[model samples]
Target: MTDEAGSAGALTATAGGGRWPDLREVPFKPRAPWFNGDLQTIRNFLVVEGLGRGPAPPASRRMELPLNDGTGDRLLADYSQGEEGRGLIVLIHGLSGCSASAYMKASAAAFDAAGYSTLRLNLRGAGPSAGLSSDCYHSGRTEDLANALRTLQDQDDRIFQRGLCLVGYSLGGNMLLKFLAEYAGDFPVTAAATVCAPIDLAAASRWFDRRRNRIYQRRLLNWMLRDAVRLPLSSTQRDAIMAARTVYGFDEVFTAPRFGFESADDYYAKSSARRFLSGIETPSLLVEAQDDPWVPTASYDNVDWSVLPRLHRLSAEGGGHVGFHDNASRVPWHDRRILSFFEWVAG
Candidate 1:
């Protein structure tokens, strides 16, 4: 995909001569004034502070939001409160990231600024409750999330009784999209947003296999492997996992079997959001970076946008994986974009 900005406009397959559509082309009017500072500079400062100080948000204020997935899993939900008058924003983090992730906290801060309460759902085995579940969360596991949403809806009915908005990053994005598609009008989500999602897991796996993507591959694989080791499994299963060389091999040996899929192909076929996007009816926005090393631009082509009239696709030029550092100012373009989109929808 070419990186020529502003040349490509529409999200149609043929738009921009097959290159991913530029985010600027999407007809979105920001509810708040455009941030005037240098974003990259801010991103650099934040990165330094992030690495040195190691995420300074309050120790996540969590609650035991139970779920009846029939597996007897105890799902723990966490939230950071906003000012008195704002709405509610529900956030889901990426594969290994929990509610404590910098992006999650930053987004929560943004939502809070707009007077919105934020709920960060920690997938079954992640975060403080890692010891609570024997089975880990996979991309296809949406039942727990569905249950979480229901719980949120019930709680909101008592509190705000207004609207609920969702924003998910990476794997969480895949879950959010799939949930919306599968549960269509069943839930009361007013608007949704997904960032740097691995919409097509097969293509994403291939993308991560490239030489330049080795660092990302190694990082993620190591995390998965570490988590796999933490879980309880049979000796044969443990041996199979220990013998795996690559991420694909590990998934084939561990994730596929544990998740009840015949293989990774079956998991990808069923879980990839591209296949389910056509059925989504909620007003949703999908923001992806063409240069993301983990998620491929090719997946965008697989989407059937015509079936989802309220869906908007924003493919920008320079976000890396979930990194959308626009300039040295350290201000995130995607964060601003998300706030803008939600503000419009909320209005």
Candidate 2:
């Protein structure tokens, strides 16, 4: 990839100040006024840019990967590859997301076109894999991903031939970081990248409840509410879920109790990826937007980066919650940057 900025080196010293270079040295152009800041974020949900974004590579096949979380749950994944592959990228979707999420599909297509194999994975309860587990999927559920990859590794040699990496969005990004920090050596993961991850779970909850971000909170809660009714809940669990009116209320009533967390506060405290950033062993890139409506900048600001030798932060001042949509390329800015970073790590 060539730099748009008139610079000699790929590593430009950025104000975000880290051992790694700036992620957006070339700058991003949204191609429209409505595609700016928070609007860009909302537009992503409202419109499918596939019109002028170019054709995505054809999907190969979607397979059901068995989860070894001891719950006998099966997760779904869409695997696609190009001829003469470079490596595999396991995609973890955000909350209320699955293999079918627009961002997930867009990123998969971009990666596939770039000679990398992609697996768009749906969490335990997301997509058609919903009924496979009685328990709901949460931001803390990294063990499920671990199990899925292990199962794949045992059966497919291609998974490890070139390299294996992970790219997660939003809440999925938090779990990806957590899994890398907590279980880095357990899997042969070469590298990992996260976009708009709510590293501080509590801060993210607060952000969600804010007036400006309520639309996202409401939409996500609506999805959870719709799913709660279908979950295999006992009489009491069903009652508690019905009583929830907010994000905290839902987590306190259903998420904490079902997952063995003492309370909502405790769940957020333990599950927050901020606490695990320093412990990450594999080389990782965490992409965050300063203007994100649902995730606070402080979450990335207070992190102890010195302890994370293998981790890097791509702190962009304005990429609102995974909305790094740029018109300069057919692929999203995050996808291009992530693929570039992954290729660098693979080499």
Which one is best on TM-score? 2
Candidate 1 lDDT by residue in tens digits, 1-347: 11222233323443223422334643322212222222322232356245643223433467776566676666676676666656677888888777777777766755665567778778888875576776778887888788777766665564444567889899999988998888747766788999888989888888878886576567677777777777777899989988876677887998888888999888888998888887787778798876666788879867766555677878776565666654322335676667666655665
Deviating ranges (above 4 Å) for candidate 1: 1-60, 153-156, 304-307
Q: Estimate TM-scores for all models.
A: 0.83, 0.91
What's model 2's overall lDDT?
A: 0.79
Can you write out model 2's per-residue Cα lDDT over 211-308, one digit (the tens) per residue?
87777777888888887788777898888887787889999998898889999999999998888887787878888878788788888888767656
CA RMSD of each candidate after superposition: 6.8, 2.8
Per model, how many backbone clashes are there? 17, 0
Tell me model 1's lDDT, rounded to 2 decimals: 0.69
Model 2 TM-score, all chains together:
0.91
